[model samples]
Target: MGVSIVDVAAQANVSTATVSRALRGLPRVSESTRAKVLATAQSLGYVASPSASGLASGRTRTVGVLVPFLDRWYFGHVIEGMDQVLRDNGYNLLLFSLGGYRHGKMRRFTESMVRKQIDALVVLTLGLSAEELRQLHRTDIPLLSVGGPVEGCSGVYIDDGAAATAAVEHLIALGHRRIGYLRAGIQDEKNFEVPALRTIAFETALAKAGLELRPAWCMVGDFTVAEGQRAAARIFDAPGEQPTAIFSGSDEMALGLIFEAQRRGIRIPAQLSVVGIDDHEFSASAGLTTVGQKPLEHGKTAAGMLLAELGGTPHSLRETLMPFELMVRDTTAPPPR
Candidate 1:
């Protein structure tokens, strides 16, 4: 027998009506009681029907968002913007989160749910294999992307190479020739669009400026603040000389670098200059010099674009380039004389 609302209500010791309301995320349920009901339902393997939407007309009026991490600042803020738009348009968001980033996972995407569950799909900052993209295409619904490039997919993202180039140029213009870089991990290098383009621009900018590339100064990270701290330890502990400045790929990693640098009593810019991408909310207080872009706008813009297509306003543009700016602040300066 299928797990029904009656079964869930019995196990949760709540009325069947309560189970219905809680499962549908309706108001009037106490937070504690709602949580308990949700846990009980999950434990009982209860599946909710998409009966609320127009499933009969082959339209769910819900957008499916595939994200690598829901907790990360970038993804969270982007989802926030996307949610506001979707909600206002009488649509709901369906999220598929990986919980964390992992390297070399050979999981092929099966888009059967895409056909059954959503009217449109938004892929956020995660890479999709050609085969996976094909699977998604087979569903014949609109596919939109934010923050990363999926080949043959229409998307919106900042110009990564240009942004990285501007950041590197900021360091160079500040007269810091010996600049290091905190780069994305190997997995990002292999599949993701944002990190790979940024890395190329970083290297190209250094070369164009006639600066020497030092292998010892480059650090690989998963673009997290915690990983940035550990990478900093390796930087200071290396046997040879170190670069006077660093260009972190993201603001979160830069914050981590600054935290670790300050912990070791290294005076900002006086001892080490650090610049990062993304002017995260805390960037102002921390005084990080970075190339800033808005992830929120990326989300709102992409979601609106997708909805436009669904609303019979399709456009010919396959990709849109967003904007970025270099914000100079206390964390960077002219190299020590």
Candidate 2:
């Protein structure tokens, strides 16, 4: 027979209520008592069944994570961090992926989620509309967001404006006057505005540096390697002025530019310079200079905040800015003589 909560409570010399409270991380249990109960439970190999625990503590022991695209590098790593923290804290994960088509899926998921399946929710870089936010609020679940700021949602993310400005300033400092930009083109700026923030900052930095944005060289890469390569091709194949440096919105896109540049025998930093945001896993190996921020850390922090709120301790629901840095690498230098 499996060790039950009754046995654990009996051994710990506490009521089953206390045992449940401690196990569920509910308040009112003293720290010493909670530790004692946990130790006793561990000694007896008492593993609380999720169903039974939910019935006892009014918790589902699960967290729901909503993401726009599961295949993207940022979302995947952030989910990994959230999953690690959730599983370690004796919780299950439920993933809701839009696959980039949120028009229908967003509404449907919001409706279905109010069924009380999860104790809390973590949204990844998805812009929630006012109506959608209201639908989510109807669930009354603790909510947190990762990637960018969302209305009515506390967010954990790097400052897109700062990160982009840094990238542009780095290129400007390298004396690259003829610099172009590879931007992310999300169709709905009203929903997901992180790309727009980066775009504004990119242009702002260039303008502040007294450089004009060359329309011929600026193109949208959609924050993916394949699309980035295509945009790079357009920039190179286009008529008129070619940029000596290009600032890509993401490392994935920047990598594509490098691949395309090399294929065309364009010597990096000599004939063309490249800089990007997001120190993607391949950045170092690929020698990408970028504004680096850890998506995994964003995931873990957001999940931790939601879990704390679920455990009867709520954190500030304001924007939590994660750290970022300029990763200078081999891909950038002064313009060719």
Candidate 3:
């Protein structure tokens, strides 16, 4: 024998509607009445059924988060931040990890799978094509993005190009003229153009300083430690002048460069200064200098935006650019005379 709203209302000498509103924490119920209803419900061991409540209110109080890669540091950090914010506001998270091959998953998520599950959607580090976005828009799901720009959606993102420029500027300020860049060879199937933006920023900054943009000084590598290690070996062994500074697109790659460089007795920040983007956890532990983009903040903000829309609040549809900071550390210094 379970207590229902009727039992709570009768015990509190209140209407069933008042008991229901009090249990849901809606504003119309006075505090005194709410307390009475809560006390009655607790004494009778009455609990509100989320399934029944959802059927009545037409809201599940859940948010769906779609991320392209789960193993990467940036995506992981963002998810952690989003989880905290959503939980605090009485919303549950439904996470879907799109595999490394993101193209196929992206199409399916927007079309058949995610439409009915969540009240809102949060996408991370992924660029949905125009057509795909249009199809998602048709679902009328409140959408928010993190990590990159998305047209016709509210989002929070860091300027990847500016962050890249800041990393290069730090090395330049240290008087390292010959800088080598380790970057992704091409965009993956997610259609995210992060690598392209980094490349353009690197070249733009170098050109402004009257430095020659040498193709040889640039090496193509994926966002993996192994790829960075391989690229480091090729750069150090190539028949040309060794660069005094190395700017890696990611902290993972930068760590690989430092490891390989140390094994060969190459003194860090003396013979070679190294700088990386995304101040990941390992960056601090390794004392590696980096350009910091707050992925956690980005995720929290994106979740907040989606929640606002779900709450029937007015949410602006535009790119939200989060700021970046330069974290100076032991890895970067002036090249030796």
Candidate 4:
């Protein structure tokens, strides 16, 4: 027979109730006691069944994480941080991929979520519909968002508009008057606030710097290397004067643009300059200049907030903006004379 809670409680020198509370990560359990109980449980090979525990405490000890795309670097890193935190707290994570911004998929996911047993919900980079929001609100569970702000909910994210402005300002300061913007064009227009804010900030920065917004300089890509290559080719093949510098919405696209430019016999930082958001892992090696925010930190913060709420200390439903830095690399320089 498997080791039971009684064995763990006896080993930890605590009551069965206390052992249960500690194992479930409930509040009021001292850290030392919790650690001792966990150690004892581990040593005894004791594993509490989820169904039994949920029946006793009315909590599943699980959190549901909703993401747009699991393949993206940002989402993957954020999930890693969140999963670590959840495991540390003796909780489990249930991941639900919405398969991009498809309305039908979102509806189906929301409907399915209503049947699942979860203590909290975390949404990454995707906005919820009004009906879905109402459904989740009715559950009265802690809900957290990452990478973008949601109405009437608490979230952790960087200021997309400010970051975009800073990136464009860096190019402007380097004496680049003609600048291009490469933006992600996928996702439903209504739910795409992050890119919209960045686009607005880019235009605002250009206008504030007394530079005309050239229609030919704005290109839309699918936030992929191939799309970036295509955008770069279009800019180069155009009949008019090309922009001296380009700002991509993501580092992957920026790297792709650079690779494509090199393939066409164009020199980087000598004939063209590039800037992007998201300091992707390969961005450093590729020497792509970008505005960087810590996705892992965002995940940790969101998880902390949810745990706090679960522990009966609900935070205000205000959005928290994380910090960002402008990373100067070899790809960005002053416009060629």
The residue-level lDDT of candidate 2 at 85 comes to 90
Tens-digit per-residue lDDT, 274-313, candidate 3: 9999888889998899998888888788777776655545
Candidate 2: where are CA atoms >4 Å away?
1-55, 102-108, 188-190
For each candidate, what is the lDDT?
0.81, 0.83, 0.78, 0.81
TM-score of 1: 0.82
- What is candidate 2's lDDT per residue for 158-256, written digit by digit as tens? 999999999999999989899998987756344577888999999999889999888888898778899999999999999887899999999999999
Task: For model 4, state the Cα shift of residue 120 in Å.
Answer: 0.3
Candidate 3: pairs in clash: none
Clashing pairs in 2: none
- Residue 41, candidate 2: C-alpha displacement in angstroms: 29
Which model, 2 or 3, shows the larger lDDT? 2
Q: In model 3, where is the ten-residue run with the lowest total lDDT?
A: 50-59
The candidate with the higher lDDT, 1 or 3, is 1
Winner of 2 and 4 under lDDT: 2
In model 3, what is the error at residue 320, expressed in angstroms?
Answer: 2.3
TM-score of each: 0.82, 0.82, 0.80, 0.82
**Looking at candidate 4, what is the lDDT of residue 264?**
92
> lDDT (0-100) at residue 49 of candidate 1?
70
